[model samples]
Target: MRTAATLGPRRRPVALMSFVAAATAMVFGVAGCGSSDPAPGADLSPAATTAAEVVTVRDPWVKAADKGMTAAFGTLVNSSRADVTVVSASTSVSPMELHEMTMKDGKMVMQPKAGGIVIKANSEHVLQPGGDHLMLMNVASPVKAGDELTFTLTFADGKSVQFSAIAKPFTGAGESYDPGHPSMSPGMSMSPST
Candidate 1:
């Protein structure tokens, strides 16, 4: 047998080059088998992959107010496989707070939500007049009917979603904001008017 050591220097180089080319071709052929397409049962939906994209607000509306404080109501829908929490909200119109209504001293009272508003996976959280809502405090300008306000809701994962809500006149909730009252405990009161 003619070994590489006995072969001419030029033939030795050509044989080495052929071996290298064959190895490269084999490696690339194996690598090309991995298709760019997602595997079967893989989730390709935007909501399933993103945090803020998974949550959406439906029928969003703000309670019209001349000044002071007001609230926004809507249905928060989460379409992801995991739950999402609305940790905070922001807008140029006013400072926003996540609030909830609860019974205190035999009366319904509105208070700042301690943790946040949690929207369960594939479910909805209703922000109604007498339920969990977004409170706009010390509005810089009057919110009139038909006026649209943009708000950014920050999630627990530091992701945020921007949404627009139309202001609508509503006066039947019996909700009142008193920043000075000690009984309110850092929020407004939602006691029904007697």
Candidate 2:
């Protein structure tokens, strides 16, 4: 009588067939599990959605001034799918207003931004010096370098984002304020942050 080891050549084929059979079974078993219909009374409702902040303030900083007026500059990015307008700004130091610069006749005129600053979906609204900026008027005290100020930005959707801006002495000759700007005066000094 031949033992299984003695019939090695013939037994090899049988072993391979058994392995193939086992592998096929395992593959079908796992696939069948995912294809099965849901059990009775199973909850099929979609997942609940949560409100997320879509507005982001980047590199916010306040320009230090000797007088009672200064400005804040930063980039406002809107990540939401809908359009958003920044309606107003508030701070403890003074009343804040969104300002925009435009050429009136031959000179630049800086005034309150009309209809606020509109930040479109997935776009950025840059608030920089001598262009679009946050004007802090009637400040209670002069802002010094290294001072921190808290500001709240309100949007059209009743959503508000609070951020802190550090006061810095920014001195660059590339941009200049309009002559009619509230901060421009004979004794007033505009020093850029170092």
- Candidate number of the best lDDT: 1
**RMSD, one per candidate, in order:** 9.9, 9.7
RMSD of 1: 9.9
- Model 2 earns a TM-score of 0.64
TM-score of each: 0.71, 0.64
lDDT of each: 0.81, 0.75
| Candidate 2 displacement at residue 186 in angstroms | 14
Question: Evaluated with TM-score, which candidate comes out highest?
Answer: 1
Worst 10 residues of 2 by lDDT: 43-52
> Candidate 1, after superposition: displacement of residue 159 in Å?
0.5
